[model samples]
Target: MGWIAVLVMVSVAIALIAFRVLRRKGRDDGDHGASSVDFSANLALAVYLLVLAYAAVLCRDGLSVSEADVQAEAESLTEMYWSVAPIPEAMPVRSQIRQYTAQSIDLDWPLMAGREMSPIPGQTLADMRATVLGLRPVGEESKNLQQDTLDRISEVSHARIVRSDDASTGLESTFVILMIISGLLVIALPWTLGVRPTRSSIIADLVRVGVVVIGVCFIILISHPFSGLGAVEPDAFKAAQRQYDQIDGRFPAQP
Candidate 1:
């Protein structure tokens, strides 16, 4: 992204320099049309701003959706863990939940960043469902708790699949290319004016170019919610881990 931004800046700088030379020669011949050039440059800038704003919003929405999915998945895991606390016979189910959670955090997180799903986490979760369904309840209270646990387990499983799907989601490559093209146009539009190459005019053009470059770079940085520096963290899963640890150490025993 940085390289792309630099390329844009360099290209704009070279174009401005050539425009300056052309304007200097034209000025000697009294062949300048300042009013017309200014009108066209202003029109181009307006269009560029609209495109940039739309692209920024798209990237932000992608990030928000990814974060929401992570939060929902973690909350479901936490709920599933707590639901098993009341029934002693549900200990095996609780242990399975813990294993599934750990696998999701440790094994699946990296895969998510690469927009890939890990088979082991899904298999671990499947085994957890089987363990939950295999439980037999004796009294009415135990039966109720068993049903609640099963519901929560289903919620967790459903959330896990959604998380995997969200992990694979990102801004389309075509949109990114279009944004880059628009950014190039934004930088080059002013040069097309053939306006006066006054010091203030040149400085103002450079500032506008800088702003466009920075904005496009920001859009690129957040283009992928699961990859790069500003990408969403697995803090949700880590919080779930802490909650599990507070209730019981490493692995809970099965009754």
Candidate 2:
């Protein structure tokens, strides 16, 4: 499961704990000490909100960096495609490159998003190398194209390596602990302030609950997009595929 799902489960556990505490307090105090609870709850809620805001910013920056890496890989693939056109017998080689690029984007993207390794990244790399070796020519232009293709391959390979490293890192335990603490603090805050129990007080309690629920939901939604943080760009992948098809059409495979 993704970290978001795990975090959601943690939040639910916090909610249950809060509910039990509130229920017990209600039974013993009979709404006589609502004012005291309210003050404490408000204070806790304020602190939790501040911490959550900071966490959200950090998550956003991390996701942006991840996305940039994917884009870089896409650009490298594009350059590789352009460079391959000058090589002798480029059609078959172009087709192979296109397929590899597409697989990286379409298949590998989903796998990385789930923090899993693709089953065939190695096989794909081997196939690409074979294709590069098959395009034989002795001219300087051909040599340059070969070097460019190698460079592009290296870039994409490095991107995948980085993503693999990231997958293992997972969420920091400290962050998860802080999130749990924040949820608990939010629930406890209202009771500690000794707020009086009245119709208005009950309404205010409901409002606080609503605010916490909304905040949690928003966090979940924002985090959802990051689940695909290390995936390749679909648009750029498609462009490479198109270029591959064009080259294949022009050069037709040998009998």
| Per-residue C-alpha lDDT of model 2 across residues 104-197, encoded as one tens digit per residue | 7667767655667675765786677777877676798888888788777888788777756654444445644565566666655665543334
TM-score of each candidate structure, all chains considered together: 0.79, 0.74
Best by lDDT: 1
For candidate 1, the TM-score is: 0.79
Displacement of the residue 18 alpha carbon in candidate 2, Å: 7.0
Q: Which RMSD does model 1 reach against the true structure?
A: 3.7
Per-model C-alpha RMSD: 3.7, 4.3
Expressed as tens digits, the lDDT of each residue in 1-255 for candidate 1 is: 565657676767776676667577634223356466557666666766777787778878888888898898888888777767666777876777778777877888788877887788788878877877788877898788778877877787788777777788777776666656666666666556545566776676678778767766666677778876468788988898789776555345444
| C-alpha lDDT values of all predictions | 0.73, 0.63
- Name the top TM-score candidate: 1
